[model samples]
Target: MSDTPQIHGRVEPGFEALREVFTTNFTDRGDIGASLAIYVDGRPVMDLWGGQADPGTGRPWTEDTVALVYSATKGVTATLVNRLVEQGTLDLLAPVADYWPDFGKAGKEHVTVTQLLSHQAGLPVPAEPLTRQELIDGTPVLDVLCRQSPLWEPGTAHGYHALTFGWLVGELVRRATGSTLGALVREQIADPLGLSLWIGLPQDRNSSVAPLINGRPDPAALDSITDPEVKQLALQVVAAVSDPDSLLSRTLSTNGALPTPEASTWNDERIWAAEQPAANGITNARALARMYAACVGEVDGVRLLSEDAVSTARAEQVQGPDEVTIGESRFGIGYQLPTHAAPLLGEGSFGHAGAGGALGFGNVTSRVGFGYVQNQLGASLIGEPRTAALIDALGGVLA
Candidate 1:
């Protein structure tokens, strides 16, 4: 691969530094194919994409190329739920059983929508192992979640619900709106904002999706890091997540649903067609940024969430050492609050990072929305270095 990959897209005059950072990601940071986009005050400031869509086929990453954004889908899912809250269709404080009575089983009778969204409901993983077919079918997965008991007392602690969060929340949306989460994403959020995002991608659009080149961290890379503190932190994270019996591992894998650490199963079309609200969201950087931009301010006269709603969504709901990721973690209603794991534009910024490197977030203080998607998957449980570099450059530009 050439050190200088041909980069595409425009940057607003003042945001030229972002383009440089984007280019550096390919040349220096091991980015295979990726797109980065930013919007400030409801206007596009930077839109860039480059590298190969399929390195094997020699297909160049185009403006329309979309990639699966793993758990970054959580941010999008959070937006949908919050929108329902804003419209008075779903109440945050109401028991989830009010919508789906079966969710009330197994000591979950009192699990509120707020607690579930905030990752405080303690339904991190189902007790039994689930097959990929079962997950794609959706019904078997929902049945398992409804019957499983919480790992801890709901609202007493928090853990990342890597896979189950989708079914738990989607069931509520389904019962309340008589529509699937994917349909709501299109009718309520994507279509209104003119975004190319989808929780359940269509068959015709499948060809436009970029296949992921999944990977994990190299021990040699960690050993070579010059910063002692950074190296130690990286090593610790790798150890915790790699341990099969650890909460991080079980929660991420859904107790053997995704047995592989690399999770190459995501590359399958069947998974892409299914609705996994907490994961498997297919989109480009432009759509992701625009979606978040609308959250904080108007975009083309469309505002997804009002100022008061944004405030409520971003207000800290939980904080402390995370039981799943084993680090300091924080959350708002359904959005991830800024922490060492996900340093999303500092205070008043909320978003979620995926299992790989995908990220999307909106900052209320700066009226900024940022999105990044890539086919190259990174292993870092916390923030990936490539994203950290781009965010630092963006922060410099804002300063």
Candidate 2:
């Protein structure tokens, strides 16, 4: 068990010290499977993954293996939004209602692209308990959201869009590009660039996708919060999760699978098959890093996001209180900021972390794209063990 895996890659000789850091967290564990890849100044530097793809079957994880990144998919979604802006097809400051007319409901006629991308638009959980079928079905859920009221004045405050964030933003892309975000991503970003990332995971590729495992060993005790009003809302959230029919529960249930309280969401073959871009991006470290590298540099002469687009992508937008998702997340236009909310490659770096420890992001500061994906979900608000350790290792290399 002490013998760490010999996963392939070419890490610089001096940087080989990171192999121990990588092994430390990925140490032999039947329930865990992951992969990590780093590209610095537009070149592949480190790539590794270990543990089992599925403990019951004894399948070993490999370079090509992909895992559901949960929220980490947000950074990628943000990238696509920036790409559209680059082509002048979409405007960041323009009102969202320009593309989707019904989105102007509840005094939200002025909500702009920046507001939605930065999660300041005030739509976290839907006002209605949307069914899981309603969500994976796509059109129905979006219809509810379009006609729903804003939780607050759009630009006055900021909130995180927990589950519906992707669709809220993805729909804008659909209206602007005449293609679903997943379709545009595959045709314009993933396929042309040869990156293994997928927004709408294909059924044929299901075999290589890793399964998620709850590893919080310790979880938050809501009982300690003590405030009557706050406790009430928390309890409601708890009840919604325990109630399998609740929208939050059903939206994540996915093809007969039950939703767990700690895990943000699950990707059954169906969830993956749908184009839920803001979350449910199932790809491995190799794939995530390779795709992000395109944003950081040219890959075979193809750039997914222009240098200006990358700059715009990394620009910080919401930094104080994130009304919708976690209490406070430092967010850029569409990507998670390198602030305390989501720690990553380092300050000035931008990326996203999924529920639990699954994380992925790229660094415009160092011209690097780094990604780490794991099936073992961590309990932390931002991410898990791999995040801190991976960033530390990357910091050493960048230093």
Candidate 3:
């Protein structure tokens, strides 16, 4: 790699710092291939990308390269739900059982749609693991979730729902609107905004998506932790995640259904064809940013949410120690707030970060929409240095 990575895209004059930060990511921070885009006041201010999309094949990341952004899909999913709410087809505070009666059983009778979207329904992991086929089929996953008891009382606590969130939201949407989440997204959001984003990726677009490169840290690296207690806890968390039967592992694996949740499973086109709204979304950073930009303001005559909807979605729905994440976290309607997992943008920014470093968010305070996607995975829950640097640069530019 050169001293300065050859970044391809334009940055508004005063925003030159963004290019410097983006270049440093490849030269200094091991960013393989990624793209970062930002929109301000409903206009594009920056659009940039660089590096090899596939290291093995030496495929260059291009202006149109799309990456599978794991959890960042949640931000888009939440946006879809919020759209329904705006249309009065779905109510955030309405009991979920009002739409899907099956969800009311097993102590979830009182759970509201907002609680499910905010990760407060305690359905992070189901009682039984669902097979990949079941996940693809969709109905089985919904049946299992409806019958299982929540780990805690609904609305009392918050935890990252992970895999279960998709089915919960998708089922509600299907019951309420009689359309799949993917169809709704294309019809309402993507078509209006002219974005290339997809929940259930179309067959023709598969060739443009860069394969994910999983990032796993060496276990020996843990020995460097100075605090004994912190080291032990970290190891314990790692152990739970590695164990096939553990809640974290099972939920991620869909009960040992996926061959490997992190990398291989997603490479399979079948996964892409299915609509796992919580994950498996594919899009370029520009589309992600534009989607978020439309959330808070107009983008090309399209506004996804009203000001009232934006305010409602960004309001703090749950905050405190998360049962699943095992740390202090915060969430709005369906988006992660500026919490430990993704403390980027600004005070009132809300978005979702993927398993690796992919993130998308809109800041109502600054009226800034930001999106980032990378094939090179990172090991931080908050974000790797590359994303942190770009966000810091953005903050400086805004300041």
On TM-score, the leading prediction is 1
Clash totals in order: 0, 7, 0
Can you write out model 1's per-residue Cα lDDT over 5-106, one digit (the tens) per residue?
A: 899998999899889888988887788899999999999999999999999899999999999998899999999999999999999999999999888988
Task: Select the stronger candidate by TM-score from 2 and 3.
Answer: 3
lDDT of 2 at 108: 76
Candidate-wise lDDT, in order:
0.87, 0.73, 0.85
Taking the tens digit of each residue's C-alpha lDDT, what string does model 3 give over 1-399?
445657999899899999888888888776889999999999999999998888788789999899899889999999999889989999988999999998999899999999999999989876876667888888888888999999999888888888889888988999999999989999998888888789999999988889988775644557666677556656666777768777667667777786333777778798888898998888879988999999989998899999999989989998887787665679999998896545787677989988778889999988899999998878643336677888989999998
Q: Across residues 1-399, which tens digit of lDDT does each residue of candidate 2 receive?
A: 445555555576666866667777766332367787887777778888777787678888876788888888887788788888998999998999999888888877899988888877877656565567677878877887777788788878876675668889889998888899888878877787677888998888999888787765434546555677556655665675567655455444431232432443564687888888777787888767777888878767778887788788777786774443323567778888876535676675877877666666777778788888888776532335566776787788778
Q: 112, model 3: CA deviation in Å?
A: 0.7
Ranked candidates (lDDT, high to low): 1, 3, 2
Clashing pairs in 1: none
- Name model 2 segments beyond 4 Å from true: 1-8, 28-31, 219-267, 381-383
Ranking by TM-score: 1, 3, 2
Question: Cα deviation of 136 in candidate 2 (Å)?
Answer: 0.7
| Model 2 RMSD vs true structure | 4.5
Model 3 stretches astray by more than 4 angstroms = 1-4, 216-236, 259-261
